[model samples]
Target: MGNRILIVDDAAFMRMMIKDILTKNGYEVVAEAADGQQAVELFKEHAPDLVTMDITMPEMDGITALKEIKTIKSDAKVIMCSAMGQQAMVIDAIQAGAKDFIVKPFQADRVLEAISKAIG
Candidate 1:
């Protein structure tokens, strides 16, 4: 089996887009979450090899979720996703334990590169 992944995004289309990219690249999406709270719950439930998390969300926001996930498993691999101008949050995410990050209007190659670099 390929590396398992959990995707967290508030927008349904965004989640679908990421899921498509991952599945096409031979990654297995074990679960999907619409908010950071769900992301945390799903992370615990799935224990995926890696996670793709959105920086902003309704319930908890990615940074908090990332920290929570880290507390659950210190070595958990997470990659934050942000829109065009969220560089500050991206830095915070890295400090909070995200392995890397990807920008929106998602580029297939960049997304794949970040995931591969994070998990491999």
Candidate 2:
């Protein structure tokens, strides 16, 4: 929870909720993005210790951005966020190098657990 984190989600509310969870838990939210394209750009600029990425997004998707970020920093620690039941997408994300994943309607404990596992 001490690591710097970048949050990527198309919904402003989702981003805000995540930021709230992370900040309250003593994590630094270095940057936030509304889409995968922006997420990739911000990743380069911030070089955050971790990234929380949303699967379905505009301009680009989390998987694509994850791949792009991996190209930039092969060891980038990215934790994907997805809605429930997107099994194929979750598998794809894992295969593409996501450190972990969290399902939406984000539970504070679950979020922290994923972050802990990813950053540790």
For all predictions, the C-alpha RMSD in Å is 0.9, 1.1
Model 1, residue pairs in steric clash: none
Lowest-sum lDDT 10-residue window in model 1: 1-10
Worst 10 residues of 2 by lDDT: 1-10
Model 2, span 1-120: residue lDDT tens: 349999999999999999999999899999999999999999999899999999999999999999999999999999999999998999999999999999999999999999998888
TM-score of each: 0.97, 0.97
Which stretches of model 2 miss by more than 4 angstroms?
none
Backbone clash count, each prediction separately: 0, 0
Q: Judge candidate 2 against the unseen true structure and give its global Cα lDDT, from 0 to 1.
A: 0.96
Candidate 1 residue runs with Cα over 4 Å from true position: none
- For each candidate, what is the lDDT? 0.94, 0.96
CA-RMSD of model 1? 0.9
